[model samples]
Target: MSDLAILKRRHALLGEKAPLFYEEPVHIVRGEGVWLYGPNDEKYLDGYNNVPTVGHCHPHVVDALAKQAGKLNVHTRYLNEEILNYGERLTATMDDSLSRAFFVCTGSEANELAIRIARCATGGMGIIGSDATYHGNTSTVMELATNRKMGGPKRKKSNVRSVPFPQMYRAPKGMSEGALAQAYAAEIQAAIDDFEKRGIKFAGMLVCPIFANEGLPDVPLGYFELMQQIVHGAGGVIIFDEVQSGFGRTGSMWGYENTGIVPDIVTMGKPMGNGHPLAGVVCRPELGDAFHAESTYFNTFGGNPVSCAVGNAVLDVLEQEQLVEQAAEVSAYLRSGLDLLKNDFDLIGDIRNNGMFFAVELVKNRKKKKASKKKPLRIVNMMKEKGVLISSIGADRNILKIRPPLPFTTDHADIVLEKLTECLIEVEG
Candidate 1:
């Protein structure tokens, strides 16, 4: 069948609301490290996928999956060494206090379970999330996905409070970094105080420590530390949603590592199984123990042997290849190239990056910093025509998201930069 025919069939079944990228969506049939192959055997640089972190169809991970499936594929109810070992490996990477793990299939499930544990352990009902954030699709998690509504009127639920993201690029006028931190921190405190005023117990806060969805906004120093104190003082836990920003995406093992505020609960997915459906919530052992005593929970497919094997293989690849260090090294190189592009292009208003995940903001008038998502939209479609893949982020959708796999090298970045230059020129024209 032709590409358009296939796409029409897909839309017939999936509905119009189902999201697909590009004005002319390419029929991607295969993938390798940081590259995708279209139906006609055309190769496109994959610069917008962090899900296949170690790389697409990695040999080691595929082998592990095949071997485990041939031997056994059973739930965690049985004595499974793979699950146990994978859990140990996962928590070993977290803070010492966060030593327990509960497996789930998606980041949504992980986050939902994390909040439940928080409410169970703390006996509180109020939760905090950023104004532009996406936790998951589940009803409870969707309430926290303020980005889904694109900054519209938020849910009237008092249990969930949305805070303005500490975005330095969009910080209020006349505010230095220090004052910005103070102002953002003060907003959080006020939210907590409002929770108290309404007689709502402070359950905890759910935040993307790296703020990946909000175009990976530059974090304000001292803000996390101050918020940690306030939340804990009010007897609440901190839940870090590391679905996109964790797993070495931000040049660190964990997003909270540089923030100086260790999270009480950490929910991870996407890159956890390196393209497989594996994810979970990690928390302090005591918190899990307390929750377990009151309630019993189990997922049939979660933490099974096959998923565990895939997770283990992903860790193995990350460790053996030192992809974390590679990401850091290559990101510096890529950063320099992006900076050069910014120098050459007047449309680039700002560049925010951490590790391989970077956001390039396009503006109509750089002097006024006037954002125009239409420019990025044009650039996105143009880059597609040039065999490069990237997308936009944020409510305005003006920030181009450049997140290739971990194996992406400086050579690949060069192609992206060159093609992006051509796209920008066309947009300028």
Candidate 2:
């Protein structure tokens, strides 16, 4: 079928919810390593997909899945070494206190369970999330998707309070980093007070350490640590949503690893099974145990043998290839190239990132540092036209999100850099 016909059928079947990227969406037929291919085998560099963390259709991962599915594909009901071993391996990456694992099929399920655990443990009804964060699609989790309610008229969740993320890039005229940190934490403290006053107990804060959708804003130093302190002080747990930044994206095993605060619970997905439908939550043993004892929570396909095998393979590839280190090295190279572009093009406002999780905030005026509101979509569409793939995020939709596969190299970074520059030039001119 033709592309337009497929699109029409898609809209007819999937309705307006069908999201296809690019002005002229490419019919992606295949992917390998860090490149996507069209029906005619036209290559497009992938700089916007982190789901294929180890790279698309990695043979190592594919083999693990195929082997496990053939031998044993049972659910967690029966005795299974694969799921047990995978859980053990996964928890080993976290702190000793947070050594328990609860497997679920998607990030939303993990988050939903995590919040349930938080509320049960603390006997609280209030949740705190960053102003522009997207947690998940489930009803409870979507209540925490504050990104949708920030700039528009929408029904507010009284129990869920939103706090401003510490964005140092567009800080008030002379605000120092320390001041920025204090101000954001203070907002949380005030919210906690308000919750107490209204007789609503504070369960916890759902945080994405990188603050990805808040434009991957350069979070102020010591801000997260301070927020952790306040949340625990208020008798609430800190749940880090690592769905987008986990599994070797941020040059580490977890995005929260470098943030200095040890999260009480870490909700993860997207890259867990490396394109497979797999996700889960890691949390404190006591919290998980308490929730398990009180509630009858069972997912039929949560920790199945096949998913565990795939999960194990993804982790193995991450370690054997040293993708974390690769992410670190290539991220630096990519940043350096972007820094050079920032020098060449005044449209580049700021480059905010650590490791492969990057955001290039475009600006129309260099002096004013205003967001080039409509340019990112146009630039990404043009980049798609030029045989490269990328996307945007944040409230204004002006910040370019450039997270590629973990196996991306310096060579790939150069290509993205060149294409990004050319796209910016074309868009600006």
Candidate 3:
């Protein structure tokens, strides 16, 4: 079908507001390692998808899925050795405290279950999230997505509160990094105090360790440490939403590994099953026990045999290929290339990256750092036309988000940098 025809049908069925990339959406028909193919077989370098963590249709992952499905695919209610094996292997990569696992089908479901566990274990109702971040789309989790900065109408939920995520690029003038960290951490304490004032017991603070959605900002030094002190002091747990930053995306097994503090719970998904619907929450044993004891929770297909097989295959690829180390090396090379671009392009304000994930903020004036909201979309569309796929993030929608599959190499980085430079020139003109 034609792009216009598909678009028309998409709008009719999925509603006009369903999101699509670029001004002219490409009709993708298939995918392979680090690339997507149009219906006509024109290939575009994939640089914005994290779901296919290992790579698109990796033979190993595909084989595992096929083999498992051919043998058996059933819900989690029955005895499933795949779940037990995968769970043991997965948690062994984390801090010893986070030893228990709860299976779920999506990042949203993982986060929802994490929150439920926090509330149950802590005996509190209040939840905290970043002012300009997203966790998921479920009703309760949607509360975290409703903060004013996201441009959505605020949901009036008394039990939820949001604090400014710390970022050095936009810190108040003349404030030291230490002060900035303190100021940001103070916001969490303020929220906790507010919950107490309003007679709401504090549950926990949940946020992305690297603040990926907040433009992948360079968090002020010592922020996580102060945040740990404040949250734990208030008798609240810490939940790190590693949905995007986990599975070696951060050059580490987990995003929290880069941070100084350890979280009480971690929710992960996206890349877990390498495009399969597998996601989960890992937490302290006490919290897991309390949650299960008080509230019954079971997802019918969360930890199915097929999903676990896919998850295992993804892990196998990560280990056998050493993609985590590659993410570090390639991302460093790519960031250096972007640094060179920043030196030439006055529109480039700041560039931040976490391993394979990158955010390049565009500005109308470098001195003022005024976000150039319109230019990013233009650049993204232009890059799309150039046979490269990229996207934008941040509250202003002015930061380019380039996160590709794990197999992306320096060659792929060169293509991204070359296309980006051309787009910047044309957009600047």
lDDT of each: 0.89, 0.88, 0.92
Q: Residue 304's C-alpha lDDT in candidate 3?
A: 91
Model 1 ranges with Cα > 4 A deviation:
147-154
Compare the candidates by TM-score and give the number of the best one. Answer: 3
- Tell me how far the alpha carbon of residue 419 in candidate 2 is from the true structure, in angstroms, after superposition: 0.9
Candidate 2 residue-wise lDDT, 1-429, digit = tens: 889998999889999567788777789899999999998889999998999999999999999999999998877888769988999999888888888888889988988999999998888989988878788778888876655443322424477888887788888888888988999899999989988888799999998878887789888898988998999999999999999889989999999988998999999999999989999989998998878878967888888999999999999999999999999899999988888888888888999897898899999898899889888888888888888888999888989989999999999988898888888788768
Task: Rank candidates, TM-score, best first.
Answer: 3, 1, 2
Colliding pairs, model 1: none
| lDDT per residue as tens, model 3, 1-429 | 778888999999999988777788888889999999988899999999999989999999999999999999999888879989889999998999999998899999999999999999999999999988899888788888755543443534468888998999988899999999999998999999989988899999999998998889999899999999998999899999999999999999999999999999999999999999999999999999999889999899988999999989999999999999999999999999999999999999999999999999999999999999799999989899999999999988999999999899999999999999999889887
TM-score of each: 0.97, 0.97, 0.98
What lDDT score is found at residue 321 in candidate 2?
99
- Total colliding residue pairs, candidate 3: 0
Q: Is 1 or 3 the stronger prediction by lDDT?
A: 3
* C-alpha RMSD in Å of predicted model 1 compared with the true structure: 1.4
Q: Which ranges of candidate 2 are over 4 A from the true structure?
A: 149-157
**lDDT order of candidates, top first:** 3, 1, 2
**TM-score attained by model 3:** 0.98
